[model samples]
Target: MRRKKQIFLSLGIAIVLLAVTWWVDLWRNTEATIQVLAARCDIPAGSRIEADHLALISIPASLNRAGYLENQELAIGRWTTGFLAEGEFITTNRLHDRARGLSYPDAALGRRLITLKLEPAAANGFWLAAGNHIDLFLIPHSQDRESEMLILEQIRIMAVLDENTGHRLTDTHLATTTGRLICLDLNVEQAGLILGRLGSHDIRMAVVNENPTG
Candidate 1:
């Protein structure tokens, strides 16, 4: 009888120990969380990180080691290297400097940023912004005999320069005028072709695509 009683005591202790362990695990899963910032909305690549786009989130500590940003201040004003979705954790590896905007052309290998001059009338009527693709048309000096032939197929506009100064213009107010310049992201040979013809040929722009690039 004593042996049976000892067996029951051991079984009871085992049950209690299992229950305690289960409870401890459940509590830890709920309580052990790491605080981090995540994208509150879809953030486009190359966009400067804004406070409204971020949200504070608490995720399990074990998963947080996967590389999540903890400080909100550190993320603001930094340009995103790629598109990040909502609820996605902002990692340290995907940010770039806004002041150093050189990475825009780095997306396309072997492409160099070059400035191209076009008459406001030939261009997109002073409405072009960055990421716009335009086909180049060459208008000869004599208008009587020849037609304007397409010189280039599709050249991506990297940026639009200010009307007076050479500063980069934002899409919000790409403020266009007659002499506004456009920065192109093209291959070395293509850049050379355009640069050589700028003074001689009457180059014009025909908008192919106006979508914003990330």
Candidate 2:
């Protein structure tokens, strides 16, 4: 009789422990926040959100809550939870979209893509990578010609092509490549002006430093 009583007591304790654990897990899951992407206020789609414009908020228990939740803080440029799959908990601050000012001409319309060959000596040992901003230093020909070294600052590197594979180099090689064909973001007129003076003068690239304020 005593043995049977002891067995029942053990079973009752186990059930109580399981119930408490399940309840604790349910409570924690409810407390966790779900992140989503939305306007800082009300802005049109496709309009760029500046670094100072957008904010991040955390929602608890609900994935598709319409209104902003209380006690959630704005993680400036950190919550970019747009276009996420369902049931995913939004953690971390990498969800914010970067702000870029639109100022380039429509090169896809009728312009040509200029390929600038960077000599290994002048191209920082081919350490220059694509998507980096560079200053173009053009050493002009003699006075009989146009002997001047004009510097164009903040020219973006569009593509970095490889000579061997005839393919664009990936970001992995960006750190230590010896040669590259860098595409410049310039229109036909600007392209013509730069290319026309290429061979007559020395063409070198200078990496542009990021703005201190940014």
Candidate 3:
């Protein structure tokens, strides 16, 4: 009976010692360092990045020696770092930070702003939006004579405001009823030419299909 008790005590002591050793190893292993990306390295947009560009990400001590470690791959935007959400992969090809060419002429000071009113029959079904390029069609007539049509291509649509209230088209729901006042990015002289020709004939809008690279 005494021998049996001694054997049980020995087994319990061995189990305790094993548990302590495991706990120490677990604490030590919790100090692992992981790789994380940082954005302060002057990484410019459209610059390709690789794993080497990342900085080390440190795990908390509490999680270090848990016998399980997870390594994740991350793609971060330029000048950014950290674990990205799932399916959020970043690349240079997808970044479009460059200024659009259509908005260029208006960047100058003292630029002329011209409002062109479009009736439903004239405004291309009122399907125009800001930032769209259009070709202007004008019907011209000599006094008491049949009118001729003139086509001006490559005009820009600045805004589609409301004609009745003279307010900008703010609500999409009021679009069909508000009537459209189209702002054309034209020079003072050009605007005058188009406005003078408005009623003599008819005005129409056409979409301008420009090259994407241009």
Better of 1 and 3 by TM-score: 1
Show where candidate 1 strays beyond 4 Å.
1-21, 99-189, 192-214
TM-score of candidate 2 to 2 decimals: 0.43
Model with the higher lDDT, candidate 2 or 3: 2
RMSD of 1: 10.7
Which pairs of residues collide in candidate 3? 29-64, 30-64, 30-65, 34-57
Deviation from native of the Cα of residue 165 in model 2, angstroms: 1.6
Tell me which of candidates 1 and 3 scores higher on lDDT: 1
Q: Write the per-residue lDDT of candidate 1 for residues 13-121, one digit (tens) a residue.
A: 9999999999999988777787899999998777899899999998878887768889989899898988899998888887776633435633486677877666667
Provide backbone clash counts, one per model. Answer: 0, 2, 4
Tens digits of per-residue lDDT for model 2 on 1-214? Answer: 9999999999999999999999999997778675554345544223433434444555664554544423234434343434333333233332445543232342345545678776676776766566778888887666654366788777777777876665777662344544567777766666777878866878887778767687
Ranking by lDDT: 1, 2, 3
- Collision count of model 3: 4
Q: Is candidate 1 or candidate 2 better by lDDT?
A: 1
